[model samples]
Target: MSTVADNTTVTEAPVADLTNVLARGPRPKRPSAWSASVTFGWRAVLKIKHVPEQLFDVTAFPIIMVLLFTYLFGGALAGSPREYIQFLLPGIMVTSVVMITMYTGVGVNTDIEKGVFDRFRTLPVWRPAALVGAIFGDMLRYAIASLVILGIGLALGFRPAGGVLGVAAGIALLILFSFAFSWIWTMFGLLLRSEKSVMGVSMLVIFPLTFLSNVYVQPSTMPDVLEAFVQANPVTRLVTAVRTLMDGGWNTGEVLWVVVASAVLVAVFGTLTMRLYNRR
Candidate 1:
């Protein structure tokens, strides 16, 4: 009886130890945040590599817009093709930057839905910042797209009156605005479930915002009702501010407001997205 009891106790001890080990769970691994961010960036680059055609619009659309607008509406709009191209180029560039920001949300939603991000969560890292860094790194592609469009604009005889420094400054401001806009979309992507729905939701807000601004035409030419909206629109202010800077015009208020507004947006959306990411 004593020998049977000892054997049973020995068996029970190993079983209890095994149960405790299983209950304690696997040890969490520590991952470097910067390394994770770089990994996310590489993932983005790989995606871009596979879908090279994804960038067609950025590469081809500018030329098409310049051709169509310069040929079709130039006479009625600006009296000549050259004049129309000059006027339309800035608006097209700004609009393209704004439109490109939409991809940040779409990319995020796609990653989340496709289990790419789920895999990411299994790794120990500053997960939220890793996502943000990925989105920001992708913005570099958008910036390059903008630069390519601008280069084409120059080839089409669209000159900035503000010289090289002014052109650089304009590009800088546009890039900053794009980076800020990306955060809002990132938040949306993190909070949303479906990738396809992101565009619908974003456009529902962005289209009117871009159209109501001084994007395709001067605000003064718009009807009073429309003009009022354009005058007050943040996008309008940003475009005008960039134009003013390029044209060497005085508009300190516009510049100040754009910077302040962009900063506020980055802070608000970035914080909200981080919180939402943690919850996820």
Candidate 2:
């Protein structure tokens, strides 16, 4: 049907025409990858705001670990609790970052369970923005862990012979390692069925690397086989590098190894994570 009013002519289209027109309507422009990633990162950080308790593991765990090791085993391990703290802080910092990285997987798995990832997948932004943004948010957790451990250790008569710059460099390295390590958990988050499973598996991996390495004790004290594993363990390298840096030593060999290991980890796990994410 058609009607004429003033100088305008109006025509009624078929119902299907209106439906088809709407189907072809323009949508909002998609954001750039960086912008999208920042937006997503903000959202990921917001998760902590809503659930403040989620930060307990990062903030409190470092304190507990530092205090426990310093008080309980410090005397036996390093001749005195005070002396042991000097040797233990760097190792504990590395272990703290390693343990906290698992929470990244846990958070991602929780999002998967809640269909948040599905919603993200439907967005017009870059596909990897969700994971990247979450990683950015996770860096804050790493910072908190490192700072708390260092601060508490300082209060407990632990002094870094490397001074401020050394401590800063060591912390920077640890954070870099944590970022690289988180990719492994990111892949597991994408592949695993549940958060609990990821946590269990991650802890299993963490325990051996941390306990078997020169964290609480020197590798020289261990059996040959155990010492061999510790020598090759990346965690050992990281701990040694941090200790060297914080102790004012310029030995770049262990630090180089940590860098290489972190780079390799980022390359392998990052690729795997992206592949699994796309498949999902």
Candidate 3:
């Protein structure tokens, strides 16, 4: 063995040049905005596939909320759970969907903390695709939560006088509002350093918006000053529009308000969110 080793010639193979072997052709075309966003949206959906526990919020939590409110406040509010479910369902759907929008911010913060966003920024794709696509994915979750509440309400004897068309419109408007509303949280995600802080601020803003408004009670029952605030609440307007739609009619004024407010939220918060995202 020693004799063979000593006799063997020390011939080293030459290192291959990866520069020539690698992608020597033209670079692939940059993805279009729609394509990039859809790709990112698929990524978000795939995240849910890997971690199905995320469905808990859209499914179980909404179910719990539907049950808790229908029974807990039904009798006191409307003489019976069945009767109150009619009034309570749409508003609660709004509450649950909007409340869950904060998780968008939490998710953004988590991704940023994990350096996922850092990698995203280095990619050659549409700038806002990640944020927009994340919102698109969240739109699905919002719809799921809305449907969960709606299904639970239906089972609880809640009937939509507006029927299928009305219910569809109601759900459509709610999802649209939730879509625009998510931008606010994305802004907070970029501004905040941690998920807890993002969630805290989101809750602080959401609770007062949802609770102080007409979600649980009519503004008529609130004092004048409180009622004024409730009337001014954008969530109140959205709920009113959704409720009216589900009740077989349209609330022109509230519907207009919701539309205008949605536009404003997307314009303002959307701008701020993009700015922060770029800087971050």
Candidate 4:
């Protein structure tokens, strides 16, 4: 206690209590949603840097597929390896990129298991920041995969009649569609218990959808029932759309159907993922 100039008594508050309050208030400002997303996206890129093996599927797998399919089945399927490659490149591009979306689920599940996900949940950033960042980061993988396929195809004498602009358009469309398709895997990541399980289930579902379509052979050659399934397959439609674009021709019907299908997938799976994320 001390005597004031006016003669009134004064008391000082405890210094330790005030220190704690001031320390709590001085925390760094929470980032905006976009900033948070970009920050997390950078983190994801760094993760890939640390684990370069994450790119094996996008790089090596495409090379193997292009070489294997063109050499092994080209004569039987098409007139020659060259002709088969011309048809096969676009289909393989779409199918391989789509197949890699399952890795998003596996990655997310691994984060959850590692407790990184729970820490993310406590952050003051947008709730979907991690998911969006992961998806955006995957665009790099998609581009790398596309480049690998195109580069190998070109080396193997597979030329695109679509010209550079058309090839560029096809690649852009595939990446856009892949981004939308990833939400379904993200939902699965949130719902599933393990990354291995997610990978297993994703492979189980994806293989049939891809193989049953016109990825490897002409649908016209299939049995009537198989042809119908091939015709209705969304992957087949996407491949057709890509083929048309790569051929420098417009196939509005196929492109529109693929866009509509992608929109529906994004809407459905995005909502489901968010719901599950919140619950978790």
Please, what is the TM-score per model? 0.83, 0.89, 0.92, 0.90
Specify the poorest-scoring 10-residue window by lDDT in model 4: 5-14
Residue 221's lDDT in candidate 2: 89
For candidate 1, what is the lDDT?
A: 0.79
lDDT string, candidate 4, 77-172, tens digits? 888999899999999998899999899889898999999989999988998899888888888899999999999999888888889998998898
Residue pairs clashing, model 3: none
Best by lDDT: 3
In angstroms, give how far residue 260 of model 4 lies from its true place: 1.7
Looking at candidate 1, the ten consecutive residues that score lowest on lDDT are 129-138
List, residue by residue over 1-280, the lDDT tens digit for candidate 3. 8766655533221224445567877989999999999988888899999999999999999999889988999999899999998999999999999999999999989999999988988999988899888888889999899888988899899999999999999999999889899999999998998999999999999999999989888999999999999999989999999999999999899888888888999999999998888876
- Kindly list the per-residue Cα lDDT of model 2 for residues 1-280, writing each as its tens digit: 2335522432345555677767565776889999988888898789889999988988889999999989999878778899999999999999988888998888899999999999999988899999988988998889888999999999999899999999999999999999999998988888899999999999999889888899999999899998999999989999999999999996789888888888999899989898899988
lDDT of 1 by residue, 147-233 (tens): 887788788778888887777777778888888888888888987778768888898888888878887778889899989999988
Stretches > 4 Å off in candidate 2: 1-29
Model 3 ranges with Cα > 4 A deviation: 1-26
What lDDT does each candidate get?
0.79, 0.89, 0.91, 0.89
Greater-TM-score candidate between 2 and 3: 3
Give the Å error, residue 37, model 4.
Answer: 1.8
Between candidates 1 and 2, the lDDT winner: 2
- Which ten contiguous residues of candidate 2 have the minimum total lDDT? 1-10
Ranking by lDDT: 3, 2, 4, 1
